[model samples]
Target: MISASAAVLRAGDRPYAIEEVILDEPGADQIVVQVAATGFCHSDAVARAPKFVQVWPLITGHEAAGVVERVGSEVSGIEVGDHVVLTFAYCGTCSQCADNHPAYCETFVQRNILGLLATGGARATAAGDESVGARWFGQSTFATRTVVDARSAVVVDRDLPLDVLAPLGCGIITGAGTVLNVLDVRPGTSVAIFGVGSVGLAALLAAKAAGAESIIAVDLHPARLELATELGATATILGGDNDSVAEQIRKLTNQGTHYSIDTTGVPEVILCALGSMRARGVCASVGIQTGDVVLDGHALSGKQLVSVIEGDADPRTLIPHLIQLWRDGRFPFDRMLERFPFTAINEAEKASLEGRAVKPVLVMS
Candidate 1:
């Protein structure tokens, strides 16, 4: 096993501690990636909370971009020195994967969420040989290094900056995928995006690219709303600016938006997003919910709510598309980024948790 400095999560509601850990070599079909950069996403943050299985001593950053340091004997089409982005783990042999929906791969929860690596053992350990949970979402990129199944990585052009493209694995893809890949959005369609965070803003950008006619951005943070407006939102609404956010949205769109998306998992906000859509309109939620979302029986007459993961995208295809979009100056998601040294992980996490930053990318020193 090789040594690397890693952020160890030992408790819920506690800060990450930098500690030296033992990292194992890649088994066949897996590769050792010297992580170049990684993004902080809400899904990674949720592992710290107690609701889920509190697998302590876990290494927990998933949005990874790195270079291949070692290639597995069984892996192909990838080689050393390739720049890659780590995506959600999927047992590629599963039916869902065969259907081209790796996001919903049958083993998604077992592989990605459960922290189960290909070898069914810890890839990292503590000083005295204590098992440390590794492979969180197939990479656990919180450290300076990681080992991942070959299928979880997508090689990108070397010229692309890893800092900004890192988030495409999850956040950016979720938003854009839901818009361009999942929903029936088209040119001149009225759409509204709620929350205006990474996911929401990504949706805004995608909607603009899709030629959405009226894209309304809703959020409590005026700054995020303004940023959304600058990105592509035709209008912005302050969270407290109206008695009813749905009413404001409906009134603004004449009847209501033809479609809407909620990146804020707040149940109330989710309901509002559902309410803000026109008849037969669809609403998608990318946020982690705090509680149940109950809909009005009448509102359910034609409106539909869909829960999506990883934007329902096949990473291999979607990530490359995003790269092309970025190259064409269509998707400028980099404007929402801020960089931090890998050593300042705790401070970075704080900035992200408290809403002080939109997309905090940690650079490996």
Candidate 2:
């Protein structure tokens, strides 16, 4: 057993607390990871919200990069001391996995989101045998140490810094993959991204890399618009002024954008993106929508609306490609990161929610 500090959500609507927890050694096909850095994503907040009561007493985190401390006897092609990123866990035997789409694996609900242990047991026990859940996203990365399935751990280049690569597992992949894989954005195509957060910005960068001639970024924050321009957005739309946001995009794109993505998840913003798409144009929804999203069936049918999960990417392939783009200075996603110590996770989450931080990473010592 090993003692580790974890930021745990004991119950819904309660703040996360740093607690000393016990971590068991790796079991078959499992590996123990010493988390170096973890990204504080909005999904974590969503999971902690009262509406999501699926998982409790859980360690909340998903986007993480770390070093492998030990590998289980049954694990292969991995070793101790390997640098890795813990992405969504998948059962390799699932139909989705067989089709090269692990993100859509049927077992994702149990293997990653629900914090079920490798042996289908609980990860923690409080005083007098109370249960404390771990294995969130198959890594429980908010903790200093987490046991993860071999399939959940993707070995990355050791030369890349964990602080830089951590968010690539989710936000970056979701954004870029939506453009490259789901949308299949082509050269000279026009693209518009609604809600220029980390995910939206990543999509803008990918669109630019794909040789998109006109890339428009929409957001209420002017600062984010400035950053989007730096990252290769050809145009910007102030979201607050909806009077001509769609008109401006139409003007810029000649008719309307060939592809549109909504990362805001707001009903209005989604509608705006759909409205801004050309006839039969593809519009991908990559945002997290909580309440019911109302839309006109005619509008959606005319626009070919679609929802993308994890950008419809195969992480093992997409992440490395993104890292290579980063190395080439074409995809500078690291610019979005604002580092903080693990103790300040709550503050970081607040900053991210308030738009003060594009991507906040918690560094563990």
Candidate 3:
């Protein structure tokens, strides 16, 4: 057994104080990780909201980087002290995995969303033997130490800083993969990205790398728009005013953008982006939005629209490619990060929601 400090959400709307939690040793097909850093994503907030009552007292977090401190006997290719990134868990025997699409594995909802350990039980607990649900996205990495399935951990270069690379697990991969893999963006393609957060900025960078002729970035924050331009957006649209945003996008792309991606998850922004697409143009929605999306059937039929999960990428392949791009200095994802100590997780979350920080990484001692 090991003791670690973890941020626990015990039936509250927000994450409360960090408490000492107990972690068990790795079992078969499992590995113990000493977390170096974890990215504070907005999705963590959504998961804690009332909408997600399925899992309670869950240790929340997904994007993370760490070092393998111990490995189960059944695990292979990974060893102690190996640097790694913890990705969303998947049951490799599912049909989706058989087809080489683990991201869409049918068991993803069970393995990752439900926070079940590989042993099919809880991996963490409080002092009184009460469950402090772990295994969220297979890592529950809000804590200083995590035990995860060996399959969920991807070994990365030890030379890279964990804080800087942690975001690559989710947000970064979702955005970049949507453009490079899902859309298969090519030279001369006209693309418009709605919501210039970490994800949208990643799409912009990928589009530029693919030689897109025009890259349009739509966002309310002037600072984000400026960053979008610096990252590779050919044009910027202030989306605060809904009516004019589409018009400005149309003006920049002439008839309309050939490919449009919505990362904001705002209903209005999704609709605007759909309307901004040329006839039969592809529109990919990568944002996490709840509630019903109301849209005209005929409008959607006229323009092809599709939703992508994990940017339609296999993390094993896409993450390495993104890291290579970063090494080449073509993808400056580090510029989007704002680091904070793990103790200040609440502050980091607030900063992200208030637009004060584009992306926040919580460093663990």
What's each prediction's TM-score? 0.97, 0.95, 0.95
- Model 3, 1-365: lDDT tens digits are 86789998887565557989997666788888899999987777777666563666878889999998889889998999999988888787889987878889888777777765356435688778867778778778899999888887888888998899999888888899999988898899899999998899889888988899999999989999999988888899888776688788877788788899999888888888888877878899999864567887655757877888888778888888989899999889998999999999989888998998999999997
Candidate with best TM-score: 1
Poorest lDDT segment (10 consecutive residues) of candidate 3: 114-123
Worst 10 residues of 2 by lDDT: 117-126
Off by over 4 Å in 3: none
lDDT of each: 0.87, 0.84, 0.85
**Between candidates 1 and 2, which one is better according to TM-score?**
1
Ranking by TM-score: 1, 3, 2
Prediction RMSDs, each to the true structure: 1.4, 1.8, 1.6
Candidate 1, 133-180: lDDT as tens digits: 887888789998888889989999899889888888889999999998
Clashes of 1: 0
Residue 92 displacement (Å), model 2? 1.2
